[model samples]
Target: MSSLNIATRALTTNMAALQVIGHNIANVNTEGYSRQTVQLQNAGYQSTGGGYFGKGVEIATVDRAYNAHLTREARITASTAAGDAARLERLEQLEALFPMGDKGLGSALNDMLNAWADLSASPSNSTARSVVISRADAFAARLRDTAGQIDLLRNSTQQQVGEHVDAINRLATELAGVNRSIIETAGGSHVPNDLFDQRDKLLADLSQYAQISVVPGEGGSANVFLGGSQPLVLGTQTGKLAVQRDPLDTSRINVMFTQGALATPLDANTLGSGALAGTLRFLNDDLSAIQNQVGRIALATSSLINQQHQLGVDLAGNMGGNFFVPTGPAQGLPAPTNASAATAAATVSNPQALIASDYELRVEATGFSVRRLSDGTTTALATLPAEIDGLSFSIGAGPAAVGDSFRIRPYEGAARNLQVAIAAPSSLAVASPVLVTPGTGNSAGMSVESLYARAPSANLTDPVTLTFNADGTFSATGLGPGNPPPDNPGPPASYNYTPGQPLQFNGWSLTLRGTPTAGDSFAIGAAPSSAIAQNAGNANGMLALRSLATFEGTALSDGYVSLFSDVGSRVQNAQFSAAFSSNVATTAEQARANVAGVNLDEEAARLLQFQQAYQASAKFLQIAQSTFDSLLQTVGR
Candidate 1:
């Protein structure tokens, strides 16, 4: 090679190097921009007489400083962090509805119970009765409000899912366009560093919404897959994503990917990491469970209270009515798309045994299969009134077809439907129906103690007589309108009347204390008409409700507390996970940036090195030009 050619090659290589250095410094602060470096190689040598003449350096290619492994790790971590953050935000909103301490649902339940206790102290006190009613209404209102808020949150989450799907579709389309551009620009020999940076930025943005896997294709194009398998982008062809309602559960939202003629639905379990996955999980898992739990408390409270209230007599001598409106059963009609006209209905068989869950009934060739949504427990269909977990299932009028199915949400609206049934204070039942009296001319000091009418409707028009005998045994004569009618009618049934022992007969039990002398007797009969009808001081029935085991062998108050604890624990766990994921994502991002990101100091030093090289290359060109000029002058002379 000649001096002029060598100098020209050197000058061109340095100029290209300087330009690459300038580009790097200019994009130092650009997000997702990888540092660019100019590769240099020795130019080809020419054969000479003695040896091959050396040639100057030439520019090979401009390469991007990007670590694929670190970049992938960062993207994955970012996806996890985004999902955790989204879930944590929703959990915080839900947790806010259940404020702890004295202002929460537990406190509301306790207040209602305490009002009941106060009413028991003065069963006929108008103010006490009104207070009980007011507290009950307040409690129901609270549950309704909480349930309403939860539903609103669920709807909001669904809307957010739709919006994120739209964004994913938009980004996928843009990425495909970039892929086409990169292929057209760098298909021959070199990597399009700027286009590669643009594609990487798009990938990072896409990862926030969904877990994506990118496969490098020919001609610098990439094929992106969602959730590892569903194709999103294939070599300049973009797939669209959409949010649709789940067929089985109308309230649930599902993400669908459409590529060509095929569409696939993605659910929470299959979607490994993304904001969309987190929102779906919260809506389907956490929010639904919380709503069901709240509804469970409402149902249990109403059922138990109504049961106990029915067993008591009001001040008007009338049977007590339901204290609170019981929750109605959930029925599922045939789906609109079902070809067969099959329907199913559910009723609460035993409220005490109810589990907080939804159920699905599917008609099979043999019969029907019922599965609980919460735990996926299945049972074969039985008779019309088949009972399971406090629910009674009944088939509709006609036989169901093989493909017919229905979803039964037993507690879906329980909380919202809870209300006080009794509006009047006089309707409160707080008295017993039977009374006991000591016989006349008794000297044993035995008195009428506690009495409970186990069978209030039993014929008790005439009083039973219990006489203490000298042999320490008692004889009971059936005196309650018995004309060969009473079951226990006999010739003086005899029994030992031990002190402090309950004397039980004729569906009534009485306890007597102290010593009983001979001829000492007691009478047990229906309470006097005036006392039964007008007495306003009896509170025994109301007091008994305090210790009543209402739900799942637990008191109503304790059940509410348990539900509150569960929500709080879940909120705490979600927050912790969000924080941990955020920390990990930050670390991964830092590691990636260390490799691909540009530093001002480093770029400045490169700028100086390139500038010096350019100056040297220019000086060599100047020397070559001067040598040529001198040689030309000598030739002319």
Candidate 2:
């Protein structure tokens, strides 16, 4: 009876082991299936005079070849790699917008300058004026189009963020359900290997949506957290991610985690590794940089051109009103939660000094201060009306408030807002408003080389005169002594005549070349019809703008070059990071696979070994039955 009982136990235990081996072989290609094996232990021993005799083998719990650390590592690398790759993909799209050669912004700028140069050669030529208008219109159209494309990209990114949030909520809910099932199925007595594999696979999938941390819970349950240990799934309950408009910039979308009635916003900078984090990073960092860069160029170029154009007379002999529609002196955006009706506005005080960054203006109990958002640097403000970098900030409709705050993005939409206010060829401002008049009583040759108007002035509106003395000296005054006062030999108020030298005063300057004899006089004020038709001074000034170092002390075209090259370098770096991170993710997965992944050869060998054991157990049962029958026969005899 003892022999038969031992054979029965051995047969049942070995058959169970064989079944586990077959299971392993069957699931060799399963994604998250860990290699499993049946554990064995000796059955209860029978006490006898010769010591203890074993009752045969008993099956222990089945164990899986899984390592928690390896799975975690694989999850982390996968999350990070997904982020890097997604950011790189979007960066490539932005890079295409900058291009090179004739299709680029640089080409557009060059064409604009060339059009002005053509107008300078023939200031009254209708065709030349039309070309200038066409060029300006084309530049404005191109800028508006580029700005539109950038906004579209941002819209697309925000939509993706919404999708990711939805997916994250779904994953968290599913993981919570899986946690419940796992806890119920694995009731301390038995280890649910398939459930564990399913849970691990869910974790890996969740990590791609947002970075997550997993904590082991009672009864084989996993508690998951997202964006810094905020419980996404705790026991049987789950949380979800939601999206919202940024408090300051409504155009930007932000992520939030919600559970029950509690909602926590995820900081963009600290969202950690995930596809969603990468997408948000692109939206905040790369997208804003491109918008600022492009808009800065538009604002600086257009505003400066308008200023210069205003100093000139158009083909119709009218004062130029905005060659390109002026941008800003703009109202700053108040925060959503501002305490008062106080308002602020910003204007281009100096385009050359403008930094490509947004600013935050906040009012404390004592006073108000502004900060550059890009690097968290403070810019001083003397009072409600102050200047920072190149922007003039002033209060609009404010009375009082302790925590009143505003967002100032002076150049944010400047490109999209670019327009040509002057539509006709007759409106091209290609001539200086003031004319240079040589006296008829001149004794020698004297010529006006060039003229530049630096600012508006009453003296410029009135006649200003330069009169040559017999002693190689000249007197300059807005008074009629030189305007009608072309006389003076005194050295006290007169300047010594120098050829090819500029005579500057009252916000305007002029270069004079050649010998100046006694009684030679020049006057400047209202432009004659011939002057408006013949003079190309303002057109030359417009052409010279191409080389002006007004964009962060770099030429306007150079600013575009800087932006293009900078983006190119960023694209290259992003590509390398994407490739390296993907490789890292692959290597990490391979490392995890080495331990928990199914090996068909190993499983086959185990199958054979277990088959042999099963055969031996069967034989033992047969032998036990034969011996018992023999003993019964003897007893019968």
Candidate 3:
């Protein structure tokens, strides 16, 4: 190679090195920018006819000082971690509104139950009734507050989504600008590394708002998808996304693209590792569910206590006062028919409208009676004893009557301390007076209670005489008390093995095979026995007030408290899990960033090296100049 060629090669090599150093320094503070380096090699070979070689320094290529594998790993780690962290942050914010343990919904529910129990222990105490009402209202208020908080969070997320949409569009515009610059400057075999870096930065920023996939396109460009196969940006053009209310729930916002309202389904999984996904999960999944559960508890508690308070007689013997006014949404009541007055009496066209699963009614006439509406069964109550059946039957003053009318209420078995027990007789004969046996077994001792519980049969034509002597012994003689021979003609008789279980007690049952004479006397036992007692339905047509009872405050029934506690536990666990996952992902992302991060000190060293190389090339040119000058002078002499 000639000296001119060598000098030109040397100058070009120095220039290339200088260009790389300048580029690196210019982009020192730019995000996503990688330091560049110049690759040098011998110039293209020129072969003489006989295997000779001539060469000059060649500028091979300019490449970025980046580890592609490490960069890719870092991106994946950072993207996933960012998504999780964003989601967890949103959840934590929501959870702050509803704390766990006794101070939260669980405690409120427990307080309401305790109040009810106290009222049951002292049914006539005005203070106890007031306490119950107050506590019930507290529970409802908590629910209302929780629901409000959820709404607030949901609305906030929607606002953020709107702002994010605007941001994404702006980012798209910026990226498009970068794309134009890159295409103009270095679109072909060589792309401007800095401009490409700017574009990549925009892409990474846009992904934080939504889930995106990118595909390389012609002209060193890319097509971006918002979700699944929905295109948001194609080459130089960008798609628009708008925030709109969800059709089903106006409180929520949905993201939709311009063409045919295309949208990426916003869910925890789809928005997998981005801020938008986190906000969506918090609003739709976590906060919404908490609101629903709390609302249910409130509606149930408020409706139940209010209904019971209406039915129960207060200390002043007043009925139908406000016990616990619900603070949540107003409960829809079934419109009353012309024939009925009570809430239950109103015909319900839609069962879904029923807010509470409990019902109660207390009727006090010659005796007191309590009923539960949930299962439509009456419980024969004996609070203060009253004279009945030639013996004293106890019943409480129960609740006061509003005029001649009585109110029926549904009881929440899980929320109160009251329990039910059915009483029935064990024998079949009427020789003994009715006895109180604690109702037990399936269907509350169906056998003994069925006689009265079921409608009486009208088949027996003959009048059966029950002879109760002053002694305990009792007998059934002729229809008119005229004693006849054992073989005299009479109606057929039957016998009952158990009192509540009906056997044809007419003479036919006594003589299943043999017919009983009309005047014949049959001995039931050496002593008096009793027939099965049935739960007499309330005077009203509906059996919706039979499962209620009064009990002490210390023993509350399994009701709203348990349900509330369960809800709190679920929320706590979900929040904890999300936070844990977010933390782990964040840690991993930080580690990856540390490994691939650019160091200013290292770039500074490379700058000095390139500068020194340029100076050395300049010195070589100076030596060649001085040698040429000296050779000219020597040749002239």
Candidate 4:
């Protein structure tokens, strides 16, 4: 009876080992399935008077071949790779928008400047004037088109963020349900290895969306966290991730993690690493920064050109108006969470001083603090209407709370609505309004040098005459309405004369060289239709803009190149990071697979070994049975 019992136990244990080997072979290709091994040990020993007799083998417990460290490393590296790849995808698109050669914003601007150069050569050519106007229109169209395409890209990116958030929420809920199932099925002595595999697999999938932390909980349940200590899954419950728009700037959105009634918004740079984190980072940082750069160019182009255009006279001999309409500063808006009625207003005070960045204006105990979002730098302001980066901020209305905040975007949408306000070729300001004429009857060989207007005033165009007296002195007539108002509203009593000297009058400058006759007289005044046909002074100003270090200490063309290179560099860096992280992730995953991944050949070898054991146990059982039968027959005999 004892021999039979031992054979029976041996046969059952070997058979169980064979079954485990077969199960491993069946799921050889299953993802996240850890290879299982059968555990076996001696059933027991029965002690008698003579000695102890060893019993057959018995199954102990099925164990999984898994290493937690390798698995965790794999997930971490995968999350990093996902984030870099996603950011690189968006940056490549941005790079294409700001091109290097032809079809670029810089190219359009160059062509426009060339048009002005042509007008300078032929100031009275109607066709040349029309070409300048046409080039202006074309440049404006390109600006608007580029801005529109960027807007579309931004919209697409924002939509993807929403989709990623939805996917994360769904994954969280599914994982929570799986956790509940784990709790229910884990209450037995025999562990549910399959359920453990499922839980691990779900966790790996969830890690693709956001960086997370997994903690072992009771009865095989896991508590998952995200956004640093914010629980996404607490045992059997799930939290939600959502997108919320900035009340100050609706164009921007924020991501939040909500559990029960508690919710918190994530900082732009603190999401760790994942596909969702990458998408949000790109949407909030990359998109806004590049758009601000493009808008900065647009604002500078309009502001500089229009200012010069207003100082000149058009083909019709009328003072030139704005050639391109100025764009927005996108006034600051108080945050919705603020508890104050105080408001802040912003304006583009000096376009040349502007940089492409968003700012945060927070009311402080002392006064206020302006934070530059680009580099996380803050500037304190103890007064209102202060200028920073070309944006002037002033208080408007009542004040209350010290912690009130407002967002100020000086160049967000400035490029979107840029347009050429000049509709006719005749509106091109190629002529300087002020003109200086040398004395026709001079005998001292006096010659006029360059003459141009420096500014404008109510009486800037008023006519003035200078008469060289016999005492080597000059008297000015009809000069009261211009520069240096005449004493008693009449011409200056007298003025000393010097050869090769510049005379400033009536918002204009006149330079003369060579000796002047005592009776010599010169006339200077606003250009009439007669002078407008031959004047190309203001066109020269436009040509000078090509070499002006007006855009952040670089020429307008060089500035665009700088921006393009900056974006390209970002894309290149992201590509390198993505590839490196992906390689690391692959290494980690392989390391994990070496331990827990099912191997068909290994399983086959174990299957054969277990098969032989089972056969041996069966033969032993057969021998035991035969002996028993033979003993019974002998007793009967």
Candidate 5:
């Protein structure tokens, strides 16, 4: 090649290099901008007699400093970190509701128990009885308030899920547009570095909402997938995601893809990592479990208290009524598509045997089946009145169709409905129905350890007297006589008196302790009527409630403590997970930056190098022009 052509080629290549260096330096702080370098190559040589002549340098192409694997790793780690952080924030809020120490549900339960103990001491004191009722009301109020807060959290999470889904759809659509622009601008010859940067930024934003996988498509376009397989963007055509209400649970929100004719619900477990996944996790697992636990405590408390209260007689000489109104079961009937009119209802049979779970009752071809949602345990249903896990289910009217089903939430809203049933202090059951007393003129000392009326409705018009005989046998009078007492027969049957054994007769039991002389006698009689003032001081039944075993064999107070501890532990675990995830994301981001990030110092050095090369190329052009001028002068001479 000639000197002029060589100098021109050198000048052009140097100018392009300077422009690339300037671009890199200008975009040093731009987010998602990768550093770019100019490629140089030797121009074609000309054939000569001795050897091929050398040529000056020419510009080859401009390349971006990007690592696809590193970028993908950063995106994955960012998605995980975002999910963990979101979950941790919500769990922290939930944990704050159930504060430990004296201010929480544990203290409220203790206050209720203490009130009951004080009422047992002075059963006739109207103030003490009122305190008991007040404490119970406080306990129920606390439970209801806590449950309401949990529901609020769940609702907030559902709302956030919907918002995130909208954001994901928006970003996906914008990313597809960017992909189309990049393909058209680049035209397959060179990479559009700015457009590529814009695409990367959009992907990073989208990953925060949902896990995404990106693949290079034809003509500089990209195809993005959600949760690894679901297509979100395919070569300039985008798909949308939506949030919809769950059919079985109207309160629950389900994430779905609306790409096809029919929307398809996405499995929560299949969602790899994102804010949407975290929100669903809290709603379906953590919040649901907490609500069930609160409901379980409510059911156990009401059932046990009502049962014990019924076994005693109030100051009015009447059997104790229910202490609390039990919560009814929650039912979700089948969709209107089912032809059967058969409906199912569930009632609590044994509160102590109840589990914190929801049940699905399905009518199969052969029989009905009840499945526990928590553990997936399926039990076959028998006749109409079928019982399982303490719940008695009854089907109504006609035979159920094969596809007919019902969801039974035995304790879903129990806490919200828990309340004090009794309004009058005089109605508190704190006395035994039958009273036992020692007869006058008895020598040996014998005391009644316990006394209970076996049949509250049985008429006990006359008192029954037990006289100890010389042969250690006891004879009863006032009750009907004979081994099997006949109607209206006088006197009672005789029997051996065993120390510390309960003597049962005439629908009543009297437990006596200590040895008695032959002349010692005990009398058992009915409690006085409501008009009698002495009945107010009796607290035998109230004292017995102090050691009552309720709430799955544990004290009610202990159950609340366990629930508080569980919430605290979950919060701690969530905090740790969030921190660990953040660290992983930071490391992955640093690695990606090492390959694609622009360093101002490196760009500055390249800028100086390119400037000197441009100056040298200009000098070469000047020397070639001067030589040509001198050669022209000589030719003129």
Candidate 6:
């Protein structure tokens, strides 16, 4: 190569370098733009049968200043960090809506328990009863509100899914256009570095919406598939994606391909670790679970409260009314009609009338014969039998006239798979009564005193005892042998089977019956006589509050107060955990951005270096041109 030709090659190389440097400076602030540099090589000098050397530099190629491994790492980092942030933000919103402490369900449940206790303390106070109703109402309201908030989140997530789908489609279309341009520009030895950067940015965006697998295409484009199936993009032809409402949940959106008639449900379980995954999880899993937990709390609380309230004595000294009703499953609402309530009352008079009206009376003849259930002995009686083991029967003193019926159930072997039916519609015959001689001996055929004497020996400090005092009053304590004496000891008494009067105990009535003797003890029986005993002494309020607050009381004391504390603690803990997760995610995302963010200062420095090198090369080319021109002129002379 001659000096003039070498100078020409050097000038072209310097000019190309300058152009590359200028392009980098122009796109320094542009998103996803990678810097470029011009590579140079020495042009060889030719000599006839002599050593050859390079005269001047020639432009080899314009290359992108990017490391493939580092670029991939950056993309993966952005995808995961963005996904985490999105999930945490949604969870935080739900957590905030389900407030903890006194303001939340915990406090309302506590108020309900206290209301019950107040009602029990003053049974005649209608105000107390009203408070109970109000507190229960508050509990229900709070639960419903919390559920509504969760639903709102679900609906919002659906909208987000739609927006994300739109974003993904747009990015995919742009990527395809970039692919076409790159393939066309790369027809010869030249490569479009700027277009490659744009393509990388779109791929990073794609990863946020779905767990994508990228395949290198014929040109610079990538073939993208989601979750190992379903093509998201195909070279220069991008696949269309859309969001549709989920059939099962209108508040949620499902992902689908535009070409396909079939739809795929997009849920948290299906799409993992991306923006769509986070939103889907919030809708189908996180929000739904919280709502379910709230529902359970509401259901359990209502059921227990209603049950115990019915069993206890009310202000009028009558059995209290139902407080809460189970709104799910077993007792979902309007109580099932009882057989007794469905039948008409009997209308007969006198001894013969009792027998004649038996056919018309709605008598549930259980057909249970008397048996020493402990020993399995059967004996017939005019009255309904009480000593049967698995059999229970009730009789109507047959006063039935017309439009009356009887139901009968006979005990089967061990189990009571007995059947019942209306035996009569108008009247029916009553069984003949058998008379027996009265005796001074115990009617139970066993000493009644023995029943009271056999209290449990365990927990001796609380010795169980029975007391009978003047004016026919009575008392019993749940104490053992070593327990302390009764606090108000002088009350071994009975009721006036009381004329124009009612017995009172702890601000409530105690209606007693029959006579009592010092040594001739009438048994109080194993069961308590209090109306509250209808609840089986289980203290239903504790259960009510526990369920209301979603509090498990494995470590709590056996009382309503313990239940309240446990529920409050759990709610507070959940709120704290949610807040902490959100804060941590936010911090981590910021850190990730700092590490991978585009830096204008660094890009500028690169620009200046490449520019200066290009300028120096141009000057060298000019100096070589002048020297070559002088030599040529001298040779011509």
Each candidate structure's TM-score, on Cα atoms with residue i matched to residue i, is 0.85, 0.88, 0.59, 0.85, 0.84, 0.60
Candidate 5: the clashing residue pairs are none
What does candidate 3's lDDT look like per residue over 379-432, in tens digits?
555453332111122212334343222222222112122211101111101111
Candidate 5: 10-residue stretch with minimal lDDT: 481-490
Best by lDDT: 2
List CA RMSD, all candidates: 5.2, 4.4, 16.1, 5.6, 5.6, 17.3
- 212-250 per-residue lDDT for model 6 (tens digits): 777888666678877446677787886777777644234
The residue-level lDDT of candidate 3 at 326 comes to 30
Give the candidate number with the greatest TM-score. Answer: 2
lDDT of 4 by residue, 465-521 (tens): 888766666788778643554333224367766676657777666767776668788
Better of 2 and 4 by lDDT: 2
lDDT-superior candidate, 1 or 4: 4
Q: Evaluate all candidate structures by whole-model CA lDDT and list the values in order.
A: 0.78, 0.83, 0.47, 0.81, 0.78, 0.49
Report the Cα lDDT for residue 508, model 3: 19
**Clash counts for the predictions, in order:** 0, 2, 50, 0, 0, 28
Ranking by lDDT: 2, 4, 1, 5, 6, 3
Query: What C-alpha lDDT does candidate 3 achieve relative to the native structure?
Result: 0.47
Candidate 1 runs further than 4 Å off = 49-51, 260-262, 333-339, 434-529, 532-547, 550-552
Cα lDDT of model 2 by residue, 313-387, tens digit: 876788778988888576778887888898888899888788888888888766778898888998655577788
Candidate 2 lDDT (Cα, whole model)? 0.83
- Between prediction 1 and prediction 2, the one with superior lDDT is 2
